[model samples]
Target: MTVMNADEIRKLLPHRWPFLLLDRVIELKPGVSGVGIKNVTISEPFFEGHFPTESIMPGVLIVEALAQMTAVVYCTGALQAMREAEQEVAATAEAQLEPAEEIDISSRVGYLVAIRDMKFMKPVVPGDQLLLKVKIGRSVGILSKVNVAAYVGKVCVVEGTLSVSQRP
Candidate 1:
């Protein structure tokens, strides 16, 4: 099922055109995990200079796509948690106490602090649709580790571990 389209994704993420790597999120489990899709096309600006004769999607961009997917998973999860917390607080509040203001979790941005064990097995070219998968790992304090992978059909093109942290 399509959990989030490009329009919805834009509301959760800050990335804009030409930079937003994900086209649609086919599967999402809030903060736990998610799968996103990106359709690479010849019309992409990077293709013009990456190789004028033969276009190839950069390996770094693949990694960036993976990171973006991870962000969506983590940030959305945080937003959900915040909403639940607010609800709980409201339910338990006394009549004399005023409801607390809503926190804008959407404004929180996650940064890729570290990327490890990255391996690119094949080159991604135009016309290929990349499937990005991200799963959350152990989290300590404000930092979280996620297992990320990118695939074209059944072939794994990129795989790595990404460490992400939210900015206060």
Candidate 2:
């Protein structure tokens, strides 16, 4: 089942056209793990500069796609936590919780802090559909580490570990 389509993804992420690499999320388990798809086409803006002669998707962008997937995982978990907190606050009768500052979660963007052990096994080009997979690792404070991998068909194109931090 599709957990999130492009429109829903846009609502949760700050990225816009030409920058938002994720197309659809097929599997999602909040902060635990997720899998996203990116259909690379000739119309992609990056292809224009990445290579005029032979269009090849940049390895960095593949890493970015992985990072974006990680963001979706973490952000969705945060949003759900917020909702649960709100419900708990509402249930309290005599003990009233202080009003928390309202922040627009939809507009929030997470930063990719570090990428390690990245391996680009194959070149991604037009018509290639990438499957981005992310698994959560140990987290410290607001920073999280995720094991990320991108696959074209059954072939692994890129694999790495990414460190991401949510904005305050």
lDDT score, residue 49, model 2?
88
Compared with the true structure, what per-residue lDDT tens digits does model 2 show for residues 1-168?
789999989888888887899999999998789999999999999889889899999999999888888889988888888878887777875467677676677666678889899999999999999999999999999888899999999999999899888785
* Error at 39, model 2, angstroms: 0.3
Off by over 4 Å in 2: 94-103
Q: Compute each candidate's TM-score over C-alphas.
A: 0.93, 0.91
Kindly list the per-residue Cα lDDT of model 1 for residues 44-93, writing each as its tens digit. 99999999998999999999999989889988898889779877777787
Error of 2 at 4 (Å): 0.5
Superposed model 1: Cα runs more than 4 Å off:
94-106
Give Cα-based local distance difference scores for all models. Answer: 0.90, 0.90
Q: What are the clash counts of all predictions, listed in order?
A: 0, 0
